[model samples]
Target: MSSQPVQGLPILPGSTFRDPTKTAFHRSQTLSYKNGFAFKQTPTVGIGGTRLYVNQLSQAELDELSNKRPTLTYGQPKQAPPSDFIPAHVAFDKKVLKFDGYFQEDVPISTEEHFRIRQVGIYYYLEDDSMSVMEPIVENSGMPQGKLIKRQRLPKNDCGDHYHWKDLNRGINITIYGKTFRIVDCDAFTETFLQSQGIELNPPEKMIFDPYTELRNMPLRMYVTPSDFDQLKQFLTFDRMVSLGFVALVLHRILSQRTFPSCVLEISDQEVLEWFTSKDFAVGKSTTLLGRSFFIYNCDEFTRQYYQDKFGITDFQPVNIKKQPPEEIKQIIPPYNGYGFLEDSLQNCFSLIPQPPRKNIIKMLENDRKVLRYAVRLESPRPEDEKRQFILSYCLATDMISIYEPPVRNSGIIGGKFLGKTRVPKPGSSTENPVYYEPSDFTVGAMVEVFSHRFIIVDVDEYVMNYIEHNLESFPASVVESMRNHFAPRKAAKEALKK
Candidate 1:
């Protein structure tokens, strides 16, 4: 049969598969193979051989494939709410308070209620009150306001016995004098005062008293109520009088009623005495006594002298004078000879006491000294079947040998080996009842018998042995021979075989 040329077939440049029967180039513009493989012809460039670039499906093919496949529909796309549609619950306030200054609210007071000024703030009490009518105010102006928007009452009577200040619950309000005010918070001074009085309350979450905004010249207006105004005014007047050196003689009279015959009486102006005695106002005796009189015993040297010169009081003694020991006669007593007279005198005069040497520095110095250590396997004559491993240390200075054994129980050895030293008993003693020996007891190369086992002072540490080897000429021939002959494994093995 004559081979017929396929017409209308698009040429695939650089394609290796040219057999028309096995692989057909279709009009749909895709290459299909009878061997069940579909390949798309792509652009090619010739190097040593044809290089074909595989192409992804074209846009038309992708659209056709997408249409043929069933289109999956998830739920409809989320739609944003209309711009003007606000929820019914949303509320806005037009009249926002812009002032940074503290504002006072009028709190209503009743006969049944009494307000206690606590460190945490003012608290109110009622027989069956469960909640306090106070609003939570957040103070930060720079940040967005907190979510708590409305005024809420705190649970009350939870602590029990509101009459006792210590028992009153925290975060509650008390109506004082027909006005509404929340005890916003308290300060450290107030908290300390309550703690001193044995009244415990929850500490205020925040400090309400701003030092920069606190009015120092005027009394705290927040604490002053209509009922307390007259009393405060009188108290202020009394305070001013005391500041002006006016004595409250009524206090002296009260003290005189309780005074003994030995008490000293200091007389004051008759007019001043009469004025205080006539007034019906509450006179706080402690405040009056502390504020009015200057105790001679508490006076400093300068103050005492001034009082003595001005007031003719010569019997005053300091309240807090330190009692000193009687002076010693240095000529009669022998001086301390422990550290030399001159050194002691210098130390006492200049505070030049010698300090103990640093342990770390001493340890570092000790570390610099070469320590000769060796590991050896020992065999006991009585325990023929058993073998014990020991670490031996040789002291070069004293020519002594120290031996150590592995601990009964491993205490976490790193790197799969117990390299650290374990305490070894003295030659005649057991491990449980250990008795260590002095370094001068053993000489180098000596076969010391320990635990009834012969332990040849076999080896020195590698570094120490190497150092000795390099400086062998400096050492005695006998000493060198002993070091070299110590712990010969071949000789030991031969001796063991003969035994």
Candidate 2:
């Protein structure tokens, strides 16, 4: 019934006892589950019985043994199988988190060694959170090197928690067992794994160089001189987008004012070394490269130190940096060479190709090819010049003028184009920025200059009088009044003829 034995009788180790109430006998199961670690067993004086129901049981489990129902395993899906319950190592399988680390071991007795920096690979088994540290074996090394720490779940504190991958990072000091290991770096997988877990690793530090290890490794090391050809090839093919391309520009400036590989390719490596050693490069002086000027206002500490070492010059005063003035964008509009309006020519300039000469559609349609001819005479002292009449025709569509000399029977002057179809600039104005003649400039008795030749407007055509009268606002008030005064007698005669 209970664990109590008969009075003064000791329970044998292998003996089984019967529960007096239930008449059921039980035997001991296996003693320990694990091999060495965490394996503990309590010796029972009595043997096995039916598994004690913790809280409650199903109706199938409470039934008689002879009852043939499927074995009802309450919480079987949630709980581990009785025979297959093991640690998390089975679930994690073959994944190992590795890190590269080193520890400084003090050397108290040896005269040759002050301290020893031993490199070790830290492997953490993700399965069971167990870890092992191993040092690589060196050929002919006198000191014993191999497995430094065995694989086991290392306890972090007395609370029974173990060291996890979360506790390790680059450039951090972690105490494994008693030895303090400085985590300097890690493999690619470990870095990726830590990052994937949302852990930010510190910047990786360089491992301390060990003189003792260096001496042991000197025999196996091979040194080679760097070739100049590779450097020259790299210099020739360097991308110009990055900041280091400034060096190429500087070099091109050092040789002469030209661009790129051509400027630098002419000089040999020996010449380049000489140029670097030369005293030409200095602060406050501007250098022109790639058609652009750059001022060397200041130098970095390394550059100053290099110059100081090479030339024994120490006075490296920083030249004051001046902010460059912003460039002003000026639009130089070309003079409108024959136009309907200046704005239309500018729009043509913005177009992809040259367009047909622009015309004000409304104005052009209204006064297409309409010409206003005026008879003007040259104001010259010569007797024949005052008598010679020139016909000045002004096209209303484009404000362009053409002059013709009519054939005279005995004037002895050839009648031809006195002026081509072009705009004539007004007098007293420079050729570059000039104002041209308009319809208002050709009023009767008015003096107009056409290329330094002055002419007095004698008379205007009948159409010019009618057109000007129709569009009164298009001309100046004074010109309108003068035209009406010059033509009043002709207008009265025409009106009297009509009556």
Candidate 3:
């Protein structure tokens, strides 16, 4: 068989290197030499007879080829240290944005004993003599969005009795902001007077008793206009409105009546002393008339006489003394010396009154027992393919649960090297155990799987035991024993390795 031409050999065209001159003709030859110097000055023959040469040298010749002198050395230019400066814009981020320095500190207003009405904004008077106040409803841009609404006004009727008049006059002094204004007239006159002063007929603000503001310790005098005095006759025909200060004076007078019965004459000389005392007046200790002094007994007869001469008053009115108790008093008080009256009345009247039951702490605990401690075994046969015991504890006050795990030791499989000689427990093996612990303070619930058996933990420890005993009384003894065994402490958990 003919051998195939050698693959990858370059094929030359016919007569490509042909030359007619015999001088260009040359035969190919191979030369072999043991030393490199044998091929030195060898000539190559082709179009030009260029001489081919090679150099043979020792280690000393190679050493002389490189420069021996040291290169010119120059030190690097010196540089200054970097600056620690920061721009203002860059530093502004560190500042707090409280606007604390720009605003003034607030000063609290006093409100003790005195009723203070907080006026948030301006109160506008309506065309019909009625007043309205504005309350902000929504914010549009930066401005308040609201409408003027009418305020409730006192009734203009004269149907209220002495008790109602007393209540209306008890709050004698009304304070707006820090300033105080006396209630010198009944609600009717006071309402009209307020309107005359250009004050809104209906106060639009919240009127409340200031806990911090207190009434002045000294007694105050009240002055009424002549027109108001004339108008008062139509409103308080049977009784008079008084200030809290005057009521206190009246109480003092009543307490010391035996010693200073004549003191009423002095009071009468200064102002009219009405014998009818209203319950409202007794409660508020406020009065309409302003008198200079509460100790009327201190005034001499001359002063009383001078006041009497000036006001055209001659003598004081006598107080009414009743000979027998009123019908109402007799109804409230039982008859005397009646047979079995006290016992029969107590049985019929007081027996129906309800008494609140006392709290039972033990029953409360039993009814609302919370889980304190719980443990659950978390396992996955694939993916992670590992097992871990999770313990949870509940916080009663905060309503939060905290989780804890057992301390783990490296099983000598760190960094892909088995440095430890101890063998680790296989996954899902009975030898895989968790550390034992006492019941925690509180826990809500837990779901656990132990030994391939599932359990839902609604309660734990004594709570769980008590629930099982009470609620599951019908359960078989074996079933109850199994549940108890599941919650029991593990004795082998303390060991490092399993047999």
Candidate number with greatest TM-score = 2
lDDT of 3 by residue, 350-440 (tens): 3466334344566456645354445544445544324444554543322334445565566332222111211122235332132222222
What order do you get sorting by TM-score, best first? 2, 1, 3
Top lDDT: which candidate number?
2
Q: Tell me the tens digit of each residue's lDDT in model 1 across 1-499.
A: 2233234454445332333453333233345575787766533432323333444567688788677565444434567886885543343122111101122422257343233221212322222222222333436523243321132234324553332334332344443334333343444544554577787666443434433223433575554334433655565544322211112232222211222123444666442322233222221212334246422223234434544554565654434435478798563323444343233333454335754332355545654555567665555565631445567765444334556666544433222232233233467664333465433333355565554566655455545546567766756677666555653664688899999
Model 2: lDDT to the true structure: 0.74
Model 1 regions more than 4 Å off: 1-118, 121-371, 377-386, 393-466, 469-479, 487-499
TM-score of model 3 (CA atoms): 0.16
Q: Least lDDT summed over 10 consecutive residues: which range in candidate 2?
A: 240-249
Clashes of each: 10, 3, 22
Q: TM-score of every model?
A: 0.23, 0.37, 0.16
RMSD of every prediction = 27.7, 28.8, 37.0
lDDT of 3 at 185: 28
**Superposed Cα deviation of residue 379, candidate 2 (Å):** 2.1
Clashing pairs in 1: 106-179, 106-180, 107-178, 107-179, 107-180, 108-178, 108-179, 109-177, 109-178, 124-174
Which lDDT values do the candidates have, in the order given?
0.42, 0.74, 0.36
